[model samples]
Target: MLKLSEIQRPIERELTIFEDKFKESMRSSVPLLDRITHYIVKRKGKQMRPMFVFFSAGSCGEINDATHRGAALVELLHTATLVHDDVVDNANVRRGFFSVNALWKNKVAVLVGDFLLAKGMQLSLANDDFGMLKIVSDAVQQIIEGELLQLEKARRMDIDESIYFEVIRQKTASLIASCCACGAASTGADDATVEQMRQFGEKVGMAFQIKDDLFDFGIDDVGKPLGNDIKEKKLTLPLIHALKQVGKPEKQRIINLVKNHNDDSQKVTEVIAFVKANGGMEYASSQMLAYQQEAFNILTHLPDNAYRHGLEQLVRYTTERNK
Candidate 1:
């Protein structure tokens, strides 16, 4: 696994430049826009996307200006989407703070989100490279499509497990996969190496997302309120596995809890009991490990180097990360 300290230098430097653009946005003439944008930029996150961009680029050659630029671009794109997402989800809180929409009102939040999206587009185009223009543009479009698909399937109590996974592939994995692939692209890595990094990113992304779902069922590494998926009528993997194995009466009981989303903790507790009795948590945990191992196995095939080691650390962090 790559030491977090080893990568912290570049990641930290990248964040500095990221905050600059964000600050520049704040200096815009619109007072309401600046206020809402500041709310969204507060407490910047782990900067995972930009890190992937640099790390994957390093696999091909020395990290340089293009690397830093790519990192800043993708991370800003990610942050912008996050701001908009909070608005759409009606999510009052994010990153342990009031969401932009909640803090400054949805109108201001939406405008700030649009500003970020425009910046994301400008950031990539500023590269003055056509190939990246195509790649980043397509990724941006795919992100929207993925969100739309997820909204269509939202709150589906019995969403097909296969379909569920596909949704994750589209909604979550695509951006991460693009990070690695784009990193390789920026450095002109050979197709074979680029594809390997792409696949590696994809496997890790899926594993990470599945682990996130498992956390929703019981695990609390991310502090996302355990079992809230069940409470939200979202049929994540753990519950799906239990449903496949449990009796009709029990499944009916679980369904009732979801339908009664506003019910007390007793309602959530009842469904939690049913999941535990059927080994749902165990099932989800095992499945999560399977994906994690699959991610590591992909690492085994990559050329041995610090970059490969960095990727390995990401795999470890996928399941180990805590809020």
Candidate 2:
């Protein structure tokens, strides 16, 4: 697999410029807000979403000011969601550091999330980037719906393969889809091209999420402990598929462990073994690869260039990452 640094070569300069602009966009008059936003800027992730935005824009047409704003808009929305999500999940850590809610409080974190969301909307509106804003806004709506849907289904522990896909599609894939669509729209691409890139991003996001699901079964040394999802009563792809393949009594027993004994290490291990015994890992891996191939196929129709090549490598990175 190509290192992210190597894959980033094409958009190195653009990313630097975006980093500065994104920081400036987070600035606020209030000292407390500034401090919180500064913390957020410092603990940023691998810049994957911005990379998607830049690469998609570069592939479609010239990278312009609109593209930069679009990238910032997406980043702002993503950061806001992460902040709110930490609050909802009652999580104290993120990316190995104390989350905003941990350092401050849930109230502060929620307000900060709202501020970032407003900033994103204002940035787009001030610059007349309505199309790009709409793309990301729609994604935000889908993300919320997905979360609510998951919560509802999780309480019953009744998610099937189809519901699982719908949850992931809205929860995880929609944001990346917005990234690609916003990127293309920023470059003045027509609706059809924008839609094409959106589908490409959705496919990659699907594969990316399945890979994450696999990590819960100890498929790789992903640094995190195993069965975190099971503990949360989150029925992921591998477990869902495995449940379908088992007899009713066996399925009920496993579900009981997940629902009532999830905190027990031995029971969690037993569930993981059951999933593996049922070929759940293999089934999920094949599904992930299928989505990856679909993403690559979408890229084939775009103009062959460094940007497109970078997007291809990025897709591979997401699906193949070790940690």
Among these predicted structures, which one has the highest lDDT? 2
- Per-residue CA lDDT of model 1 for 1-323, tens digit only, reads 44556655544665567567555633557677666666556677776777788778876666666666566666666777788888888898888888888877788778777787777667667676455455556667777887776666754555767867777776677778778877877787777877777777777778778888866655466543366776666777777777778778877777877777525666766667677788777877786788788768867766688776676777788777653
TM-score of predicted model 2? 0.98
Backbone N/Cα/C clashes per model: 0, 0
- Whose TM-score is greatest here? 2
Query: Against the true structure, what is each candidate's TM-score?
Result: 0.87, 0.98
RMSD of each: 3.1, 1.3
- The positional error of residue 301 in candidate 2, measured at the CA in angstroms, is 0.8
Candidate 2: the clashing residue pairs are: none
**Residue lDDT tens for model 2, 1-323:** 79999999999999999999999999999999999999999999999999999999999999999999999999999999999999999999999999999999999999999999999999999999999988999999999999999999999999999999999999999999999999999999999999999999999999999999998889436444499899899999999999999799999999999999999988888999999999999999999999999999999999999999999999999989987
Scored against the true structure, residue 257 in model 2 reaches a CA lDDT of 98
